[model samples]
Target: MEKRRVVITGMGTVNPLGHNTADSWQAVREGVCGIAPITQYDSSAQKVHLAAEVKDWDPTVYIDKREVRHMARYTQFAMASAKEAMADSGLDLSAENLERCAVIVSSGIGGISTTESEQTRCLQRGFDKASPFYIPTSIANMAAGQIAIAFGFKGMCTCPVTACAGGSNAVGDAFRHIRDGYADMALCGGAEAAVTPLSIGGFTSMRALHVGDDPSRASIPFDGERDGFVMGEGAGILLLEEYEHAVARGAKIYAEVVGYGATCDAYHITAPAPGGEGGARAMAQAIQDAGITADQVDYVNAHGTSTPLNDSGETAAIKTVFGDHAYKMAVSSTKSMTGHMLGAAGAVEAIFTALALKDGYLPATINYKTPDPACDLDYVPNEGRSADIHYALSNSLGFGGHNACVLLKKWEG
Candidate 1:
């Protein structure tokens, strides 16, 4: 049987850079850095002093005042983004088959704040005193579940907890569901709100977080002076529909999700494989799945996590997959500005990739001063530029050796 086509009709995001897609994209294009001194809690005692936090957040804007009490921060972010995406798609859910709609929102560490608070309460009082909503709110799958409930999407409601690759996996899974005829429309992405003291302290203990005080230099991916990743919090959602269904509804198409590739290194738990072998396989697989040659890919939203291992390893992976053509293509890490959104990174970067195709622009890796000898590529340093890219890839490499890549093409029609 022939596979169906899948197209992205809408996108939504609530990131440290902005509250919506327009604001976020604008900030990205302008090379704005969102990392700042830790404001979610007092970080004076911790070695890491900075993070990318969503500013002035108010859940009541998108959800009911009373209902907000039951939802975790991650769930709230997911719901807000989903609502924006659904509205942007203009798909009348009442007119469509509810059973054919899917939701696959994901999170790497869902509601760590909720877990911390509830655990504290349990310890201080008693285990029986824990809130009834505690279990429901703290689970990683609750983002997907809550989105499904709010939007009445009853089909294939699930979450991908693949560490940093969770968000990209969510988008890829939704694409498969539509392309394989299991669903006609889907809302998929990832959300994360783990900016609490416990989350920061844990990453700090593992030496996974940047210990810098300067926000601009904290998440400087591909740069020689980079220390580690800065924790970021947000959500990003995409509305995907079968090509025919989207065309029939006259929905505005952003781009075509042509290919998805996922792989595991089977090597290390926290560190990437030597030379990013797993990431190379995923990118090659995505290109092959798209039925395109290596040279056809014009831009890469790299998984440049600012760490020494990831930046150098991912650069090697690109060379492995694309050969000399890797130098010809524009590669950038928006993480330079957005920081690492953990599970939400892939989905948000996917959105940036789609917008790059749609708007003929390439985002930049800001704060890049000294280039690493190991990572020699055109990182679109410092400033964005116009580029009529036809095909783009978004990459996400996570802990536990997970790697995911999604190939997107410009919507010609």
Candidate 2:
């Protein structure tokens, strides 16, 4: 069987840092901290009050009012990003084969806010008072479904829910689908808006969120003072097209999707394995799949989720995978600025990785005043720097010990 080449033609995101990919990348490169005091919902009673939210976002501009009423915040974000990505790609749906296109968007904890609203209504005003669109709005796969419906796509519509890894897994699966001749193109990524009262309370109760008062210090990944991750919400979508197809249509290629690797720890529910073996294997597999040496990888957009365990574990995993070269490679976590966007983190960071390859700019790990000995890596601390980047890797390690990675190659042509 002949393997087809897959490349990233366009990307879009509505993140805490910015409303679009260009704006988000600018903020990231500038080392701007998007974490702020929660204003979306009252957090006076909450232990963790700071969260990174999609500020100044008006879904009505991107989605119709009547249609937006049925969609959850996550779906709305997905729709906004899908529209941006499609416009960016300029891949004429009318000219190309619609049956060969697919949508594979994902959300980790879909519509938690919607679920809370309906449940509250059911309790206060009886179950009959709950909205009829509750189930459709809150379901995990609805993001992909809605995108398919909106765009008239007739191929492999899917949503892979691997917790926080959902977005990265979605991208990887789309790449494989195109590479394996299942689809010619795919609109794939993840969207999430889980920063609700219930989610914040649940994470606080589990001691999974940081209790810091300062927004700048709330999400300091790789820093010793880091307590836990700060909650975030948004979406990131990518337009992936076959290489020949992209070239044939004169689409601008951001980067080439060269390799992908996914693994499961099968250990604890929320904790990683003993020595970060699973993450290491995922990185190794991605490198092997890319057919490149460890030294060829110049940068890593880490799944460094501000939490102490994740930072140390990811650092260990990097060292294990890259050996001595790991010390030389630049590693950074944009979660330092954007906070942890749960399911959407993977796709957002993957875009950053591709951008890093495109522009040779490694984003900073903000608020790294005090570094831990455990995470003794060149985390590209505090400021963005330019480097010769040929291959960049992005990681998405989730709560259920799911580790997913994708390798991006700088498009030389």
The top-ranked prediction according to lDDT is 1
- Taking the tens digit of each residue's C-alpha lDDT, what string does model 2 give over 189-284? 999998899999999988899998998889999999888999999999999999999999899999999999999999999989877889899999
> What's the CA error at residue 260 for candidate 1, in Å?
0.5
**Tens digits of per-residue lDDT for model 1 on 1-413?**
68999999989999999999999999998889999888888889989889999999999999999989989999899889999999899988889999999999889999999999999899999999999999998899999998899989989999999999999999999999999999998999999998999999999999998997988789999999988999999999999999999999899999999999999999999999999999999999999989999999999999999999999999999999999999999999999999999999999999999999999999999999997899889999999999989999999999999999999999999
Q: Against the true structure, what is each candidate's TM-score?
A: 0.99, 0.99
Residue 344 lDDT, candidate 1, scale 0-100:
94
Off by over 4 Å in 2: none
